[model samples]
Target chain A: MAAVNFDKVVKSFGAFTAVHGLDLAIDEGEFVSLLGPSGCGKTTTLRMLAGLEFPTSGEISIGDRVVNDLAPGERDIAMVFQSYALYPHMTVAQNIAYPLKKRGVPKSERGAMVQKTAELLQLTELLSRKPRQLSGGQQQRVALGRALVRDPKVFLLDEPLSNLDAKLRGYMRVELVELHRRLGRTMVYVTHDQLEAMTMSDRIAVMEGGRLQQFAPPTEVYRAPANRFVAGFIGTPAMNLIDGEIRQSGGTWQFHAPGLTLDCPPLLDSARPGPACLGIRPEGVVFGSGPIEGVVQVVEQTGHENIVVARIGADMRLTGRVGAERVWQAGETVRCGIDIDRAHIFAAGAAGERLNRPGLRPVEAPAVIKAAR
Target chain B: MIRRVAFNLFAWGIVLAVAFPLFWMLVTSVKPQFELFRRPPTFLPETWTLEHYIRLIQDTPFLTYFKNSIILSTATTLVVVAISTLGAYSLVRFKYRGRESLAFLVLFTYLLPSVVLIIPLYLMLVSMGLSNTIFSLVIAYTTFALPYALWLLRSFMAGIPEDLESAALVDGASRMGAFVDVILPQLLPGIISTALFTFILSWNEYLYALVLVNSDSARPLTTGVMNMLVSSFNIEWSLLMAASVMMSVPLIIVFAFLQSYLTRGFGAGGVKG
Candidate 1:
């Protein structure tokens, strides 16, 4: 098992940059995710690591060796693509044994390995069946099994669960987390889904527009987002972001969003009275309580959970999650307050460049990050 | 439903029309000579005899021509498959300068009419001391078969999703390894059809064989069977029919073996979107 390092690695397709100077040091045996939206260069980054695509600039090293020009086979990494990409013509046994065979392993050892791996993945019964014969989840397992047979130094998976049904995806997610824990191999997973990143990664590298926006522990990144993008990108109902000037009102600060206002938390209150964006997760938006009121415009009941969308101002709408058993109708005005202590404030222009809480010295009282001017 | 039925009938009608000559050849081979010339053209004989079949064995160099055709066609097909699969793989999978130009060149080679080139080829063959030789015939046959094989197999190779091969590469196989292990097995239908196509093209080729081979040693069945009518002067209709029937047997057997793949291989369900 080896740690993979990307030192200012950059990839460009002609004039358009796909991955711009991405620097990451993935620890050995760590489960890390390169999470982003589509076209945000997550797959491109993974491909570069796998040696499928060479970076346009900088170096990529697997462990101690700089293998920027090495072939994919020389990299000792296995990737399971978004599509399972199982060989349609081969049986599950043949597909899983492909890499071992390619490596010129002895026939006896290879067969034994295939059998052992199949049994491990619960694929023994389906060994003779082709990929098309298997369900999507089973095919995905086979794809993983195929990679696992290689016993590569690093495991690279590009949204392997993205194609499965939600229920199956969740089940597979749990299985994967267990597998990662069991194997303890250096694994770099790429996905657009933040839940997958949050639940699976030892560390999450949030990205946008070919740039690494934030790379930190899941809880660290979620609770203390590096930017507004990470703050909005992570949470379920999304973080409610109201950007306006922090006007001094009655010697206390209030975040002003046109007719809307939020009492500043102590951490935010002490920060310079400047233009800021208040970040509150939908769960952090307390409803039926504070000064702000809105008519319920729409209610989406997702079994066991629901989203209550309320029209706060002439055009502004805020969404809050409630239990499916809780009944709330449209056109009824409801009061909602900000969960003040949980509210995060960021400088107006630097809302996308978050303040690092790790560097801030803790205080006996609540502390705020004085972001670089 | 009405349109589908009409289409099926029309398709079967065309198939039957194309197959009539071989069916007629088989029927006439078993009939007496007098019945062959009879009016209304009896497709089946009132009395069948093995007389022609017996005669064909003793008559001419039919066996020699059969052996020649087999050697030339099989060699040509094998060579065509090897060359075309490689050419098609490179043309379909790799990106390089002159890729389009190289593809156009292959198509141009494929489209080069044998009739237009046969005379010049014969002249070159004679100058090179290759006339009336089985080796020259195999070369000519490969020239004719390679282009279509290349073009068809290129499309088939391209139909395999790149993701499958890419995943294999990441799984520790090289690109070529991925192709041989993962992609080539999926191309079974294409390879089978291409082999059959080259074999049939070489087996049935006539103009070049007739033009280049004056000796009976190099003559194939097509030229051999047609010659039986003229060189003997007293036409043995039954023997000629027997020879004609014999000429078709390999094709029939090959088609039978490859018919399923041939149907599937004919451009349907190609790499679904």
Candidate 2:
């Protein structure tokens, strides 16, 4: 295993830029995920590291060696494509043994290595079958076996679980995490699924529009996002953000919108008194009596919890997560309270900088925010 | 039940219509030469004889022509298929300044009629002193066969997913190594079909063989068999029929072996499945 680094890497296709000066460092044996939506350059970043693509500028290094000029095979990296690109022409044994054969492993040694890989993946009984004969999950295992048999310096998986059914995806998610722990290889997984990144990554590098939005631990990304984009994109129900203006009234700051007003959290020392946005997680929007009053719009019941969306005025809607037992009907008037301690404040506009929390990293937090804003 | 039976009858009628000539050729090759002038031609020969086949093999220079045809067709198929397979792969996969235009140019060459090209090709071969040789026919046949094979294989090459090559590259195979290991296997059916086509084209090509070679030693079956009908004082119908039946044997054998792959090759180029 080796540590991987993307030193101010940028990738562009003619007039369009796909990844914009990305600088990420991953430690050896750490499970890092590049997470974003489609066209967000997460896969491009992974491919650059795997040597499938060359960065337009900057350098990519694996284990302290600059690999900008190296081919994928020369980089000693193995990748599992999203399609689980197992060779349809070869049986499971040959598919797993392909890398070893390419590397000039002797025939006898290749047999044992393939046998051991199949055993590790619980594919011993199916080693003689062609790829078409295997089910989706079984083909996935064979793809993994092909990568694992090489014991390469790094393992790059590009949305490997996206093709499986729901239950199989969950199972493979856990299996991947367990496999990462067992092998302790430096694995860079590219995925657009937030749940997979949240559960499996040691540190999640959230990206959008070809730029890295936030790179921190999953809990850190969830609890204190670097910007408004992270705050809106990381959660399932999505954090409720209301555009308003904050002003210093007397000694404290108050946020004022069209029909609702709330005192700013006292912890926000850097909360500039100007136009800003307030972000509240669904769980933080309490449904008890308080200054804010609204009519319930919709309530989505998901077995153990209820997601209640309430309209505060002519336009603004706040969603709150509450226990399933105590539910509010649609069109019912309800008094709602904003959990001030858990609220997030941001400078208002398209690219909002977080006004509440201090920036996490000087390199990632300030320059990108300044440039984008 | 009546509709099904009627459909079956119509299908069988069309099949028989196409197959009757081949059946008559086989039957005529074994019929006695005197049976040809019977008042009403027999559907099944009243007297079967192998004299035509024996005489064609022993008395005529049929074996020499057969060897020449085999060499020419096999050589043309091998050379054309090999080059076109690599050319189509490069056209489909690699990026270069003129790649797309070059592929279009290859199809453009295929669009040109063979009769329009034969004169210039004959002059080029004569100037090179390659006339009256099987090698000359192989080179002349490649003019039409190469472009046809490349065009057919290009679509087949495009049907293979790009991810498979990327997977092979990441699995420690070089670009060319990955092509040989991954792509060649996937392209086998396409190669077989293209080879079969090139072989048949070279085998049945009468105009080029007639113009390029006049010696009995270098003559292919298409022109060589026609020579027997026209050059003789009286046309030997039975011997010519025997030669026609012999000329189709290689094609029949090729079809029998690669019949499944032929359908698959056509299907793969059209739809993904």
- Root-mean-square deviation (CA) per prediction: 5.3, 4.6
Pick the DockQ winner: 2
lDDT of 2 by residue, A1-373 (tens): 3899989999998789999999999999999999988999999999888888889999999998999999988898899988888887889999999999989999989998999999999999999998878888899999999999978889999999888888898899899999999999999999988888988999999999999999999878887888888999888788899999889978978888898788776535667678989898887888967778999999988778888999998999999888889978999999998977677788887558787754332212211110000
* TM-score, prediction 2: 0.93
lDDT of 1 by residue, B1-273 (tens): 999999999999999999887788788889887788899888679899998887777767889889999998999989999999889889988778899898888789777777998988888888999988998898888887888899889888887887887877876777778878877777777888899889988998889888888888888888877886656457777788788778878898889878976676454323221
lDDT of 1 by residue, A1-373 (tens): 3999999999998779999999999999999999988999999999999888999999999999999999888888888988778888778999899888888898889989999899889999999997777888899999999988767899999999888888888899899999899888999999988888888899999988899989999877877788888887877667787777676767777778877877765543336777788787666666778888899999877666667888888877788766677678999889987766677776677334442233243322212211111
Stretches > 4 Å off in candidate 2: A248-251, A266-274, A358-373, B261-273
Rate residue A302 of model 2 by lDDT: 76
For residue A348, model 1's alpha carbon misses the true position, in angstroms, by: 5.9
Model 1: lDDT of residue A320: 77
